[model samples]
Target: MKTFTIKDNVKKFLTVLFWILIWQVVSLFTEEILFVSPFKVLPKIFENLGDLNFYQNLLSTVLKVSWGFILGLIAALFLGGLSYRFKVFQELISPLILFLKSVPVVSFIMLAWLFLSPQGIPVLISFIIVVPIVYLNFYEGLSRVDKSYLNMAEVFNVGLWKKVEYIYLPSVRGYLLSAVELSIGMAWKSGLAAEVITFPEFGLGALIYNSKLYLDTVNLFAYTIMAVVSCYILEKGVLYIIRRILK
Candidate 1:
């Protein structure tokens, strides 16, 4: 087992190294202004690390995306639970969820920009992007709840709180985690896109837009790396929280 784990780690490292090498070769062949190597991007990342506005932009983006995602998750839980109890409610909302899912994200961003402030556009777009996904995942989880367990709970006259804590929650735990993991990426991507289009006063997206405007490809790559790394950290943090709660 230890050998397999070590081998897997080495393989992953090799894969990353391979990509970095390819990136370096490509950058070398391209114009310096248009493409920068990994070495250049690293310095750009560090340069931004020392800037207050960079952190502010990053925090703004994170806050906007996180708020939308968290709100969507909460709504999904409430609606999923209610829909599980009321078929009519589910039927009524089904089409709305489908619409949200089917509509292109850019359409939402453009439409929302008309009615919302630049600051709120990202939040609204992220929320829209997340809602249907979480709703579907939560609903699926609710449907998969074991009927035998519910019947036993009813036979024993278990209270609502107890049933929720012991039965409903456990049934939905996996689905909720999956929803969070999946929706986070969607929320971040949609939120950033909205921010880019809206050009909010403060956000990573704005910084990215500015980088493109200035033709600063190095900073653009750096900002992208920062976003990817930040997203990964958030996902890992959520997983950690879930594990701690489960324990």
Candidate 2:
């Protein structure tokens, strides 16, 4: 087990190093203003870590997006449960779900900007981005639940809570996790894009926008890397928490 783990870590490290080398080589030939090298951009991540404004932006974006994700998750579960219970309800919402799935994210952001406050834009956008994924994936999982298990539960006169706890939840766990994993990155990207357009008081997107305004490629690259790292950490951390809770 330990040997396999070590090998996996080494493989991941080598993959990252290989990409960084490619990035470095490309930056060497590109205009410095347009493409900052990883060598220069990476240090800025450390520098930003020490800056108070970085935290403020990070916190604001995190809070806003979290609200979006939580709300969207709750709504998805509720609606998904309803859809699972009633074929009619699923049919009723099918068109709307299809519309959401087909619509460009930018259109949602732009339309939302007109109605939602600057602070609410990211949250709404994130929520919009998350709902369809959660609903569809969760519904699919719910639909595929083993009939034998449900029949056994019925035969045994299992209570609603027990059936949910022992049967339904376990069946849907993979689907729920899959939805969450896919939606996290989209939520962040949409939320941040909304922020870039709306320029909320304190947000990483605001910082990125400012960097663009000043032609600061190093800061832009640093912030982009920060966002990517943050997304990865968020994905892993949330999955860890979910696993622990489920266990």
Candidate 3:
């Protein structure tokens, strides 16, 4: 297993290196003003990393998106549970869920900007993108709970908590975890897109926007790398927590 893992890691590194080489070749061929070599971009990224404000901006962006994501997840779970329990409520909410899922993120961001402050836009956008996903996944999971297991629970006169623990929860754990993983990436992407458009004072999105305004290709690439890295780290962290809880 150890040998296989090591080989896998090496393969992944080689794949990444191969892509970077391809990118370098493409940039060289284009010789365009907007394109910066990955090597040059890496040094600029490191330079930005040394700045204290870089960390602050990264942290602030993460916090805003995460706060909205958690709140949205809680709201989704509550509503999904209620919908599962009540047929009328489900009927009423189904359209709204469908509408939210269908609307473009940019449309939501633009509409939200009218009523919300710049700082609030990212949170709202993140919430809008995440909530529907969670609601749908949880609702489906709840509905798909095995009838036999429920009947068995009834026969055993299992308490509400035990029924949830042994039946409902385990059945839904995979769905819930998948929803979380999917929403984390969506929240980050939508939130950052909101920041770029809204130009919040301290955010990765704002950094990207400013880089664009100045025609700073290296800075733009650096900020893009930062956003991607942040998203990757956040997803891994959320998955780690999910694993711990399921364990």
For TM-score, the strongest prediction is 3
Ten-residue region with minimum lDDT total, candidate 1:
238-247
Model 3: runs farther than 4 Å from truth? none
Ranking by lDDT: 3, 2, 1
Consecutive 10-residue window with the lowest summed lDDT within model 2: 238-247
lDDT of 3 by residue, 84-135 (tens): 9998999999999999899999999889989999999999888888889999
Those runs of model 2 whose alpha carbons end farther than 4 Å from true positions after fitting are none
Q: List per-prediction Cα lDDT, in the order shown.
A: 0.89, 0.90, 0.92
Error of 3 at 162 (Å): 0.9
Instruction: Please write out the lDDT profile of model 1 over residues 175-231, one tens digit for every residue.
Output: 878887888888888898888888999999999999999999999999999989888
Candidate 1 colliding pairs, count? 0
TM-score-based ranking, best first? 3, 2, 1
Question: Against the correct fold, how does model 1 do in TM-score?
Answer: 0.93
- lDDT of candidate 2 over 97-209, digit per residue (tens): 88887899889988988888888999999998889999999999899889999999999999999988888889889998999888888899889999899998889999999
Candidates in order, TM-scores: namely: 0.93, 0.96, 0.97
Query: For each candidate, C-alpha RMSD in Å?
Result: 1.8, 1.2, 1.0
